[model samples]
Target: MRITKTLWNKASAARLLLYKRDASPPSNAVRVLGAMLGLQFDFEEPDLLQMEHRTPEYRKINPMATIPVLKDGDFTLAESHAINLYLLSKYGGEQKEVLYPSDLKTRAVIDQCLFFDAGMLFRRLLEVSQPAFIGKIDSASSTHIRNIEEGYGIVETYLESSPYVAGDRLTLADISLGCTVAGLEGINIQ
Candidate 1:
């Protein structure tokens, strides 16, 4: 009975970890980490078309109404970059060092890459997308286009130095940037 209880608790924790209130790469980043770590997920995707994210209850989970709100037990986390670090640290176990290394220099480089994605790359995506979401424009404006291209240039510069976004190996920064890049490509961002 004691062992069974322990198994149950572990299973419960994983289930809670898998609980995804919103969808997208930010959320997908966490899911990818979980998947790579061999954890089972229970995705609870909300309908964005119907404004499901703006509901009162949904707002309780994330007042900002952001995608990929992760609910683990009683703890809720927002922001893809933050969640990636938290999940990687808490559940990464043996794989933590591989994904997010411990050395300060390596970790600092990784942190810089993540920051680039969140502040520059991902924000550029949002700038081009929000206007479309509200029907303010049919597509990205010239300035938005320039901004997107500028973001691509930044990524290119990062790769010119190393194979990965952070260093020689993959890291949380790559996961977050990959998702944002995919979204841009899906819209034919060139």
Candidate 2:
């Protein structure tokens, strides 16, 4: 019974770690990471080293000096999607079977959504939200709104077949859309 209890506890812990509320990345990346790990999160202000990206000190930790940098012990990694996948793999395990998908065929579909999320969805969202978030509503553009709508329309079409991009599963694709669409609503971009 003790061994059984210990195993159960470890499994639960791993499951929890799979999706913790992280604040380092923009809400977009956090949402993707949460979706990939099958976790929900609330956005918060992150506690980071106070320095500019181009600073000499920061470059030692991240030569690229990007905003969303992940330092896991000695292994520091970059790239938003790559970091999301790494976090899922490190913490989610078999529970992430649906999100990450072990099957090559299923994985391909998830990959397509991930790519779209990183490319078009993010692009549209960033362009639309930048002006508003920075307190410059006048900077918002109809072109940005159109771009965002196009991506959202694609997601709507994809949703018609499956509940999510990976078909009947609330995969990382859902998380990406959820985050992106939510941000759009926040900025009142329609």
Candidate 3:
């Protein structure tokens, strides 16, 4: 992704806030998409270990107090998947058509991929992470490992038919799912 002068200028002027860090897969996805769109965002890192997300102010912005919150002016949105979709729909021009197509069937497939990431891949990851973070477990259980491997198996099957997750071209689905896989890798979950 080459950053053009126009993109740089637009990014400099945009007022966007992304509450995220590199350690989080969903956060990483949104950051990549924002960069692709030439959108600059003020990053606010909420320390989960420090309980910063539990603060009253942060909770007001997001009741769930999750990371990767997007604040565009007065409008605030939670969840990285939704934020990615919103960013593409609002700022993506004709040049970004491959990232998100307008055709109903194609879009539906992309949507399904997004849901799969959220419901299956990320959900299984959370099962492993949540326990470790709260000191419930020192390592991933056999069940947790099996679930993640199954998720990857599904992704492997999907890739057999297309160069990317959803189709031949890169889409928001790839961004979303890629981040989740990257997160798992970062922790040496395999």
Best prediction by lDDT: 3
Tens digits of per-residue lDDT for model 3, 38-140: 7778899988888899899999999988888998878899999999988877777753577989888888999999999988999998888877887888888
Evaluate model 1: give its TM-score: 0.86
- Models ranked on TM-score: 3, 1, 2
Q: List lDDT for all candidates, in order.
A: 0.76, 0.61, 0.85
Local accuracy of candidate 1 as per-residue lDDT tens digits, 60-111: 9889887777777788887878887877777677779999999999999888
lDDT, candidate 2, 1-190, per-residue tens: 3454224322343322221224222345645664545553322222333335557875775686654555554566655677667667765666578577888988888889878887788778767555555566755577877787788799898888887767887776666666666666665644
- Which candidate number has the best TM-score? 3
Clashes within 3 Å, all models in order? 0, 0, 0
Can you tell me which runs of candidate 2 are displaced by over 4 Å? 1-54, 63-65, 135-139
How accurate locally is residue 66 in candidate 3, as Cα lDDT from 0 to 100?
88
Query: Order of all candidates by lDDT, from best down to worst?
Result: 3, 1, 2
Give the range where candidate 3 is weakest over 10 consecutive residues by summed lDDT.
5-14
